[model samples]
Target: MVSKELVLKAEIRKENGKKHSARLRLQGKIPAVVYGHKQEPQSIVLDLHDFTEGLHHGHKLFDIEIGSNKEKLLVKEVQYDHLGKKIIHADLIRVDLSEKVEVSVPLVFKGTPAGASEGGILEEHLDSIEIECAVTEIPESIDVSVKGLKIDESLHVRDIALPAGVKLVTDPELLVIACSKPIEVAPVEEAAGAEEPTSPEVITERKPKEGEEEESEKKE
Candidate 1:
């Protein structure tokens, strides 16, 4: 769940440009923008280390301290560098604690499926699911148990049991995972037997030449 105590301090981003952003990164800070709630987007800068640490700790909702005022916001999106290893920019959306919002949370599969004991292969199709819930009630991750899944059985988005205030936002018909029966291979002897029998070679007696046919008729 989003922690109300996780507050981030931000400052108005004055300089705006590629060079300015590069300079900010050099100082261990990144550019960010806050919008939503029908308000004008506000430019800001945040501490790279602190923001990354908060994200690593699963702090999605934050009370951003912008000078004398603080606003509750959700981490709507994050922009990463080309290498996808570093955070380049962030987009925060203002939200009310009591209002409902849609967010994607990680899916955690727990327990070994019963199908595994039956020589079934378990396959996962989704890594996360989208859900709707109050800002403060947003879950960090959703746990799905495959313990009861049997061979050839599957789990879909509709089978998920969400939290009290949470509601599904993804398609219910989407397959989340499945337990598949293993493929069976035929024995070498059986495979060979299944092949079609080759036809017997056809041989024709040599045709008699004109003189040989005449001699045969005379002999008859």
Candidate 2:
């Protein structure tokens, strides 16, 4: 279970667009929007350092303390700057803990494969899985164990263990991991089904006759 501590306050901003966004960043505030269900989109601002720290802790759910009111919202989408170093904008979706929400969870592979020790390659087929579950039940990541997996062995989507109340929405037969042995290639042979070389006498008999060629040329 992963949890994060975030403090978000309700701060209204009338400014919009590139210039305004840049100015907000200069003031150490990140522009964000919150919307979901039957509610209208609410524009809000978050503390830059606090918002970033929450993300670093991998907490998508925030206990937003908006001004004098408190609201629990799930982090929906976070947009990064061009350099991919800073958070530019964020989207938060209000949710009910009792209702199931669909979200994609990252995949994590645990342990080393026995086949890898024997020079076999380990291939991962899936990087993430979608699941429908309560917002509070959302897992940070799903774990798949590859310990002692032999060559030619595979672990499918169904092999992963999910937390209680978390249901996998992906196909059960989807390949998640596979171990393959190193391939060996054989050399090509060009003499297959070829007849043995002819003897010198046979070669001489097959050759064009020198005297016949000269007589034919003279007649022409």
Candidate 3:
């Protein structure tokens, strides 16, 4: 998959303390640092919305323009607030189109597994995998199909098919997904029924009076 291109307009930051970073955030911008590949580290800030929008659309490669200088950068990490409701900071690394770069690519599963019909539960262990490949050959996401997978079977990192230039940085023996028998869950209703309350029943019947019974026998 190819990522949608996103352009971020950034301005070089002159300050580098928490107070200054707070001030930038108050102005609706996020503080960030860009440095890698023997390049000069630059302190910068960009619009919070611009950063969030690019991330939401899965744009890994960022085209950052600082003043008259423009360079292609890659998102390495992002720090979030305690509640994870806000973006606190971001780490950007300089990238060269001709060099191989390592990045984490999300895995997308396609199709239903045959084990699902056989009452087997499917579990996904990893959502993304790290790989090193040329900048131009990097995929937005890796696609893994779960169709025809049987119970007690699992797929590992080695099962993934990668591009010609791409190499898996994660361990090949690491489990990605698996199909197994459903775990046994205790039956709540059965347990509740075992301790059911038992209440006794009462019955009463009325008898005829002696005088009324004698009159009825004489008339008969």
Best by lDDT: 1
The residue-by-residue lDDT of candidate 2 on 1-220, one tens digit each, is 6444356665766677878888889988888998998998888888888888877776778889777778888888889989999998998998887888887788889998988878888988899988888877777777788996999999998888988888889999999999999888898879778998886754445655999889889999
- Which of 1 and 3 is ahead in TM-score? 3
Sorted on lDDT, best first, the list reads 1, 3, 2
Clash list (residue pairs), candidate 3: none
- Model 1: lowest-lDDT 10 consecutive positions: 186-195
lDDT of 1 by residue, 1-220 (tens): 4444478899999889999999999999999999998889999999999999888777889889999999898999999999998999999999987799999888889999998988999889998999999898887788899999999899999999898889899999999999999999976664444777799999989999999999999999
How far is 33's C-alpha from truth in model 2 (Å)?
Answer: 1.1
Which TM-score value belongs to model 1?
0.78
RMSD of 1: 7.2
What's the TM for model 2?
Answer: 0.74
Give lDDT per model, in order: 0.90, 0.83, 0.89
Q: Can you give the lDDT of residue 186 in candidate 3? A: 80
lDDT, residue 138, candidate 1: 85
